[model samples]
Target: MIRGMAHHVGIYTRQSEQRASKSEASTETQWDDCVSGLPHWGLEPQHIERYEDLGISAFKDVDRPDYRRLLADAGAGRINVIVVHYMSRFSRRTAQETYDDLSPLLRNGVRLISVGEGREFHANNLFALFELLFKLQASHEESLNKSLAVRAAKDLEARLGGYTGKAPFGFTLVRETRRTDSGKPVSVKILTPDTEHEAPIVRRIAELADNWITENDPTGSVWKIARTLEKEGHKTRGQRMAKARGDARWDDKTVKRVLADPRIAGFDVESVYGTRKDGTRSTTVAEYRLVRRADGSPVQRYTPIIPAEQWYWIQGWLSDRHPGGNPHWDGKPSGLLSAMKLLFCECGATMTHGGSGFKKHYRCRRRAIKPGQHEGEVTIGAKGIEQHLARRIFAVMRAADDESALAVLAEAANRYAVQRERTVALEVTQERDRLLSERARLRRSREAHHADRERVMLKGGFVDDFARESWGETEQALAERMRSIDARIAEIGDSKAVGLPYEVWLTADTDPTGPGSWWDSADFQTKRAFFRLFFDRVSVSKARRWAGRGFPVETRVTIEWAGGVDLSDRPMVGVA
Candidate 1:
């Protein structure tokens, strides 16, 4: 009989289970020792309540059902005492956890007994509390050492192309026994493609994406594929796992993530750092890349569905087709000065590119950034602002005898060409490609117009003079653009970034009334570079007059020159 007010005794047992049956010795020993001298401690068999958590560890944070139930019952005053074969059987958590959990139980008139240690713990016993804390701390330290050793073993297995985690979606895990250096048996999992169900689906997904993008409909394919997969009655990994949750459908984001996973390509993943402007890699991981083996090839856990070449190409195309370069392309970007971040709102926010196709604009995205704080938005049409800045740059170069503006542009052009092709800013590269597409479309339009003009002439009818003039203007515009593009190509003397050198086309073509100036012959990239040099920041205010109201670009726009270097003594025209 126990000599206290404690009435009910809760016996808790946990086994840090391995594959073999340790339960008989582990659990029964705890029960036998606790109840062996029961009558001597003033207790009967009817007073004992058993709480056993089999195949579970006493380690911190493990979800042990019986253990929790025991604690719950004790807290509810159903059990006034807790008994364990060893103190470690009760918990291998940190001393803090023991103090936090057991202190409350003891304070609430509960007593704890450890049969193996021959110890009785109560609220008033300070030495017993100290002994319990010391033992719990030792147990925690031992578990910590075991965790480190496990991590080391797993790292070794991964290096040898052994799969360590659960198999990804398109594969099933096959685990086998392997012995460690100390002859301890360990389980290593291997991945093999699940052909009947998941593997074929993975291949089909890649094929559909490939065909859709090749057909020039690149943007919305992922969502379409998700819909297609659902229609075909395929389920996602989560959907398969959650048998009760029928509403768990596949979504575009999930599909995109699945498509991008390294596991699908049969390689382990690792996080890599982004490179700084000075060309050095950062310490923190900026993005994930496939883990490569020592020979510079990606480590293979199984046969790959998408080859590395195809995988890289698709990722690059999608990323470029959209807009993000991780700021890796520091010098190369195509389009209006605003696109390169020279444009700013009066509120000091950088303007983001807006609109689509030829209807482009630079818009202040402050509302998106701060939400309720901004009252309205600022917007400037790409055409007016770009043309205004170009005229100013050309004007300064023409008026200055030293030709300092030309020199500035020449340096920028050369500086951009130094980065390799792999590092070319995606925006500029996309711009050049888009322009080429536009030029081809225009050629087709001109061809169709010529055919219609010939039809009227063949009927022995006069094609109107106004119509003829319209054709001529169209033809002339086409020819001028073609010639300018050719000249720009010839002038770009460095890498594809520059196309040619500064010495090739630094000559002045400043006449305002001329058919075309040097500005006309500058490539989109060169134009962007020139603008970057000319302005540190171009501030814009919300247009008071817009749409049908009209463009007040001249008054609403302000400029801050780069390096505080003014390109002209003449007050800038068409700008505030």
Candidate 2:
């Protein structure tokens, strides 16, 4: 029954070689073995016998171009294309490649069969097209879904109060598992690397820094200390080559990187990369610009493998010798006032420090006297203005009626919520309309292409022109849909909706000086929340003093509340 009717069937795939007592196998080999002796659904025993005569050869590690060429030559005369699996076994990972390779074979009477899936030579043209589209869509969706899940997981992990990337150099990841009573699953813990051995080296480095400064080198730096350590045969952690930079040996930079490493102190760090408004990527520094822990005290900050006292000693000694005397202390205004460059000025001009010597003040950044502009120039000295304004505002708010003020805030919040809901509804409607239009356009293009193809084949019309027109129409539809989606997102406006504005009016009747300072007397969390809500900036301005005389500016003054009157226009006296 062996014959030459079927010439050859080439199986090409990528598979690793396995070493086993029963059999040495590749994926293709395993698949072939499974299908070889099995009865074909349509192929008679004689056809199987002829297949053996034609010869079955499996080609491993074959690339896509080689496989396509082989398939093309085989389809011209004798042979069929049967893949083990559709996507995993045979994929170029490009939609165009799939279309080009498969379309030609299909048109030239070549057949495709997935032996593993038991899908033989499917004869129905429409069914085959649908199957191919379904598979392609599934593959596309799988890749996109995987990408989104990974991004979301990475973001969540970053926010989980720990390191989001590689475990610090000192640590190693180890898999752990355990069993409970009755052999059930138990708990797991990631063991931190032991730093007991490394802690001594850190202390030594700090001590060296302190010693170098005390020796009065004046220009003594971290580099001098590192070189001194290297000469003393002090090796780095783990018998590994000492961390070096160029010919200088392990320097301060190396020591610093190691000492500042959070892993050594049993803490974690997470750095996030994000895109800026200018369409560029940026990496944020450590979170918590300045941390104050729950205990209302400054954080017990991470150490740089150096004892606190030694580091302090080194810093103190360096400061004493350095000429500039801590360059940061230049008597310039800093903190909340320094950061508020945009808020104070109406014409968007930055103010300057004006006071003589260390007693600084802020002056108006104006362009002389401008036409139609009234106010001559409001000059507010730094400390007096800041403290007076803060105390006055706090006193006013504390004296206000709590229930009435909160009711106003609640109404404003409700209005904002309603507006946001309407915006969301509008976006959904617009998106649905866009999708419906795209679907219609796609359907029309498909129908037109089918009709045009028929005309070219049956009526002997210009094939090139018809084909070009059909492709153009399809491309147009695709472009339109893409544009619509992009436009829809834009119409949705900014991603994060601004929260509603809630106002609280502060009165002068029940002032803090009247009974108790409301701010100091309020609950801790309430005080914190209030500060976060209304107050954007708080600058402790210096009190005005001149020629050894303190002006009696009505210290602890009381406000006369004119019973829900508009006293905003009235002249107000100063408070202590």
Q: Write the per-residue lDDT of candidate 2 for residues 348-415, one digit (tens) a residue.
A: 34444466645756655676756654355534455554445445545433433554334433333333
Q: Could you give candidate 1's per-residue lDDT for residues 82-123 as a string of tens digits?
A: 888888888888999877877788898787888778788888
**Candidate 2 error regions (>4 Å):** 1-132, 140-165, 168-264, 267-354, 357-359, 362-380, 388-576
Per-model TM values vs. the true structure:
0.45, 0.29
Give per-residue lDDT, candidate 1, residue 48: 76
- The lDDT for every candidate, in the order shown, is 0.66, 0.44
In terms of lDDT, model 2 sits at 0.44
Instruction: Compare the candidates by lDDT and give the number of the best one.
Output: 1
* Residue pair clashes in candidate 2: 383-541, 383-542, 396-506, 397-506
Minimum summed lDDT over a 10-residue window in model 1 is located at 413-422
